[model samples]
Target: MAKSKDISVVIPLYNEEESITELCKWISRVMESHGFHYEIVIVDDGSTDNSWEIINNISSENGSVKAVKFKRNYGKSAALNTAFRCSEGDVVITMDADLQDSPDEIPELFKMIKEDGYELVSGWKKKRYDPLSKTIPSKFFNYITRKITGIKLHDFNCGLKAYTSELVKSIEVYGEMHRYIPAIAKWNGFNRIGERVVQHSARKYGQTKFGLERYIYGFLDLLSITFVSKFKKRPMHFFGTMGTLSFIFGFIVATYLIGEKVYINLFLNERARGVVEQPLFFLALTALIIGVQLFLAGFLAEMISINSNKKGDYLIEKKIGL
Candidate 1:
């Protein structure tokens, strides 16, 4: 194991061969000028381009640079999670490899965790250089995320952030949950989260690896995190509550239909439509079945949770040790 350093820069990149070398050099310059002992841990998320080759060359020339290349593309969250495991630094700083995330913010981010008593410090790209197509959706989603997660961060998906080793190691970032790191940290009891307005640069090299589909996945992941954070240990609370309400509503509807049928048959000459002939009866039956299934689903999920591994798994094709 490498000795614990003052800072660990974990950059997760995919097909960013064009920018890897320059980004590393920039980080080295910033950290060296600040007189901080730092290690740059670059994680290549199975880039098909020459990214791994560039990373290897950079690592060979610079002892401070270490890298892990994935066996396949596992997404940014998986890359970060794997790097966090391998990082041996007091303050773990994560940034993008595309050079858009400035390395100059490292000093303050380190101070926020090491000196200011914050568990996690997220970067806010106050003035993004993205096109309207990206910025508009990002702003709307950030608004919704702030309201839902209560983290008060302007940019939850900003790749530049800092964390105490304890905070990063305590939380798991997987399944596109990298966008909700602050929220995840808060849920795990690291509530002293701070934000810094960092410099965001325009893409000077490759195109963005992400599409609008990421935002769609991000919204779903936020809902998943909200549910898991609250009911991870006791899923019965959520599923059972919803199931019980649905079952009650359906039972009430069924009882009403049956009672009306009996009343009409007893008091009027006209025959009441059979309860089975009514659409309400079928709808009520479907609701009852759905409620039962949901309750069963909760039970099944609880069982899997008990036996499933909470820590994520990933395949590393190669490692360049420091």
Candidate 2:
């Protein structure tokens, strides 16, 4: 096993050849000035450029610099997730390789995690240099995320963040869920999430990899995480409730129509429209069928949830003398 360090700065990069060297040097300077026993873990996400070569060169020169190069480009989430598993640090800090996230924020973030008892500390870029086209949607995205996840962080997608080693290991980040790490931490019971206003520099090299479509995907992922967190253990709660309501509504409407027809035919002695002929009869039938289908779906989900193998599904747990 590799020796653990006081801090591990994990950077995930793709096609960032121009900025990788400078970023590593800046991080080393910060760690040295702060007297931190630190290791820099840089993951090259299958960059076709010279980023992986630069990483290899840096790691060769600096023993504290550990690097990984993927066979092909996985998204940022995969890069970060893999690095989290490989990191051996008491406190883990993640920053973008684009140099937009400043290395100066490391010390304070480290303090927040170590001294302030924060399980995770996310950076907030209070002032940004990006164009309105990007910044506007980002603001809206953060606002909606705040409302849904209730994490209270102004910037959830900020790559410059710090975490306790335990917090990072306890959570699993996948899909486009990188933006919701704070929320994921909270769901995993790491509720002591803090935020610091950090400097966001203009990109010194390469263009932004993400586009406007990310916001749409982000919103969908937010909803997905919320649903999974709330209902993963008891999916029947959601589906069953909706199904029951729909079934009751349909039953009530059908009964009322039948009763009205019977009254008109027997008591009033007048011809009444056939129940099958009324448009509401078909509406009620459709609702009933949909309700049954949803209820059955919930039943299957519950069965799968009960029978699925749950052992070894969780992250590492501390034991005294196991």
Candidate 3:
């Protein structure tokens, strides 16, 4: 690792051909002005548009630009993971190809990540130009992410973010969780996180690729991150806790049912009845079953973790052909 490093800009494109040429030129100007060594990695995520031709032209003109064209669209996660695997700079920055994220904000983000010693710095669009439909759901999503991950980032879904080489290389972004990079970094012991109020422009060249269903998936991914981060190596801590709480609640419910049965049998002189046919019994049975299953899941996770440790499964083998 170098003391002062250049920035690697990674942009993931999906049918975003119109923005690629302009974005590459803009990034080149920034790189030249800042006097930092940089590479523009444009990952074409199986774009049905002429995205590859545009990226090739840009990468050819400027020696700084490199691209990986996916045979088919594998989503943003695959594109980012592939780009990160091939990036060569000390500071890795990621932005969307839709031109909503301003390239002019790159230098400041790079400065914060490199000079300020922040492991991760994410952009916050204070005044988004999105419609109420997108903005409303985004706010709720960010709130849920903060609550679950305990990372105080306002815009977890912001595409504009910069990460130190160590942090970027160490972490793996899969599923729809690239939006939660800050939280992921926090969970990986990279606690020095920062945020910058970046300039967010309305879509200039293409339509938004965002949808409401992505928020639903993002929320679910946060839950997965929460459990995996807090208890990846100790799954029993999480599952066991849930199991114990469920079992306790079930026990209380069963005890109340027993008391009710005793009173009914003695005071009312009703027929003696077994509890299994009762609804409370079914609830108790369900709880007990779920509890035991969760406990076993934790135990299984523990075994898998131990086996993984022995196997030495790693995410990044090398960076930029290192």
Candidate 4:
């Protein structure tokens, strides 16, 4: 087993050749000044530039600097998740490699995790240096996330965040779900999340890797994570409820139409329009079909959830006896 350190700074980079060396030096300086036994785990997410080469050179020189290079770009979340598994620090701090996230915030974040007892501490970039195009959407995204997750953090997507070793190890970050790490942590029972106003610097190296499309995907990911976290084991709760309501609604509509036709024809002794002629009949038929499909879908999901192997889905905190 690898030796544990006081702190581990995990950075996920893609094509950040210019800033890797300087960022490592800055982190080293801060760690040394603070008397922290720290390791820097930098994951190169399949960068096409010299980023991986620079990382390799840095790791060769600094024994504390660990590096991982992907053959192809897997994305920031994959990089972070991989590093999280390999990190052996009591406190794990994550920051962007674009130099936008300041290394100066590391000490206070570390203190928040160690002394203040926060399971996860996310950085809030109150005054950002990005253009309105990016900042505006980011603000809106964070606002919606805050409302949904109820975490009260202003910046949920900020890369400069800190987590306890246990918190990092317990939660899984995948897809574009890295933006909702706080929400994930909360769902995992790490509710003591903290936020600190951190220094956000303008990019010192390459251009922004992400575009506006990220916000669109980010919104979809938020809904996804929320649903999966709440109902991963019991998907029937969502699908079954919707299916039941839809089926009942269709049944009621069809019943009303049929009853009206029967009453008009039999009681008034007058010819009535056939229930099949009304557009409502088709609507009801469509709804009924959809409802049955949804219900069967839910049933299948339940069966899969029951039969699926969940060997490593849970982490045991303690054991009393065999």
The model with the greatest TM-score is 1
Task: Report the lDDT tens digits of candidate 3 across residue range 20-69.
Answer: 78888888888889887888887787778787777767766787777777
Q: For candidate 1, lDDT tens digit of each residue in 1-322?
A: 7556999999999999889999999999999999998899988999999999988899889999989989999999999999999898899999998889999999999998988999899899999898999999999999999999888898999999999999888888888899998988999999899999999999999788888988899899999999899899888877887888888889999999999998898887569999999999999998898889879888888888888885788988899993
Sequence-dependent TM-score of model 3: 0.84
Error of 1 at 4 (Å): 3.1
TM-score of every prediction relative to native? 0.93, 0.92, 0.84, 0.92
| C-alpha positional error of residue 130 in candidate 1 after TM-score superposition, expressed in Å | 1.7
Superposed model 2: Cα runs more than 4 Å off: 1-3, 307-322
lDDT of 3 at 193: 94
Tell me which residue pairs clash in candidate 4.
none
Q: How far off is model 3, as Cα RMSD?
A: 4.3
CA RMSD of all predictions: 2.0, 4.7, 4.3, 5.5
lDDT of 2 at 96: 96
The all-Cα superposition gives candidate 2 an RMSD in Å to the true structure of: 4.7
Which candidate model has the greater lDDT, 1 or 4? Answer: 1
Off by over 4 Å in 1: 1-3, 263-271
Candidate 2 per-residue lDDT, tens place, 1-322, comes to 7556899999988899999999999999999998899988887777889887787788777778887777777788887887888888899999999999999999999999999999999999999999999999999999999999988999999999999999889877777888999988998899999999999999988899999999999999999999988887898998898888889889999999999999999999999999999999989988888889889888899898889854222132111111
TM-score of 1: 0.93
Best by lDDT: 1
